[model samples]
Target: MSESNSAGMFSGRKSEGLVLVVDDEPDVRKVVRMTLEKSGYTVLEAEDGEKAIAEMKKDENSLLLSLIITDIRMPNMNGIDVINYYRKEWPSVPLIVLTGFPDMDMATSMLQHGIADYLVKPVEAEKLRSSVSKTLEKREVHGF
Candidate 1:
């Protein structure tokens, strides 16, 4: 086999998904899209919870929505609001929070309110991949 084939070469096409990634930072969104796409996930984006919800509502294909990655502090509806909304509307959407500051109180509150997991800002690709994989594999996007 050629050297490229030895690595289990990746497919250029991303997984057919409509994942909602919410964050105020454009750079953060770029990184996430790049990472998730590399892992074969088609990513959807939102600058805040409101936009996220809007995107979710526009979702066709009844996409499984594999997961949602959001930032805790954002304008015009923070991650908390997004989590709360999904809890009622699309109860099956898994949420992972990314924050510049990861406080126990906030984490506890989110967990109590149904957040699947969290990550401190500057989230590494590996961490994102692992968290996403675990969440999707368990197919427990609704439990949180």
Candidate 2:
């Protein structure tokens, strides 16, 4: 609502932070970007894991990234590959999984591995916003 908009724009804390959304589907990326942007987050998009990795390699992007939202299935390197890279190289950065296909076992494992959240796709705007906010806040509290 208007309150959320103002908090994003006029709050003393500034923006929530930069969020990278990795998904193969353009529509998915667009929706996710719009949602996060509205919540006062700067969003970057990557069509696949390779591009996400490329983005992460940059000192500018990687240093400012508060969270990463990615789909489990993607062409070229999958989300698993991205998550592995993140765990090995940047475990302090929190991650969220948004996918149409859900595997409970995989989800459980990912949660155990410290992923922030695993959300089924077509995520409600409010839910996505809340999750992103909470994840970013959690990262902030952890000093990451």
Which predicted model would earn the best TM-score?
A: 2
Mind sharing the TM-score for model 1? Answer: 0.77
After superposing candidate 1 on the true structure, give the runs of residues whose Cα lies further than 4 Å from its correct spot. 1-17, 59-62, 76-79, 140-144
What lDDT score belongs to each candidate, Candidate 1 first? 0.70, 0.77
> lDDT at 56 for candidate 2?
65
For model 1, the run of ten residues with the poorest summed lDDT: 1-10
| Tens-digit lDDT track of model 2 for 112-142 | 8779999998789999999988888787787
* lDDT by residue (tens digit), candidate 1, 1-144: 111211123235546444567788888887888887777676777887777766765525225566788887765556577677666767777788878876888888888887778788777899988888887777754353
**Clash numbers, per candidate:** 1, 0
In candidate 2, position 46 carries an lDDT of: 82
